[model samples]
Target: MIFVLGMINAFAANPAPPSPVGRTRPPPPPPGLPIDENILTMMLVALLFGIYIIYNFKIKQKTPM
Candidate 1:
């Protein structure tokens, strides 16, 4: 799920095409982490939540009613 979402986001951030007023190629993007912190934090929360849900399901099967 994340991989798909990431690919979508990558495609969404596409920069403008090269301009005739300047160089033929767009300047390289600024350095540092490619994604925003909030995006990573959200992905982490989603992954952890999935684990939590699966853990609960497994624990329920081992417990008495």
Candidate 2:
């Protein structure tokens, strides 16, 4: 049947599977934060800013309405 022939054709299309030895593997990433220093610095700044805002809110709340 045409279906059987189509299946055979599809299977035959890739005659040779690539062996692992045929291609080079990607180099391993360095051991450390995957992020850049600029990003890390920005994150730390944001954290400090958040803490500062929270502290200010707490102080205002304690002053009584």
lDDT of each: 0.87, 0.84
Once superposed on the true structure, which residue ranges of model 1 sit more than 4 Å away at CA? 1-37, 62-65
Candidate 1: Cα lDDT at 1:
100
Over the stretch 6-65, how does candidate 1's per-residue lDDT look in tens digits?
999999997997666957777778987756758988999999999999999998886668
- For candidate 1, the TM-score is 0.38
- In model 2, state the lDDT of residue 6: 98
Model 2 over residues 3-32: C-alpha lDDT tens digits? 999999998896685676757886578888
Model 1 weakest 10-residue run by lDDT = 17-26
Error of 1 at 31 (Å): 23
Cα TM-score per model: 0.38, 0.39
Error of 2 at 11 (Å): 27
Question: Backbone clashes per model, in order?
Answer: 0, 0
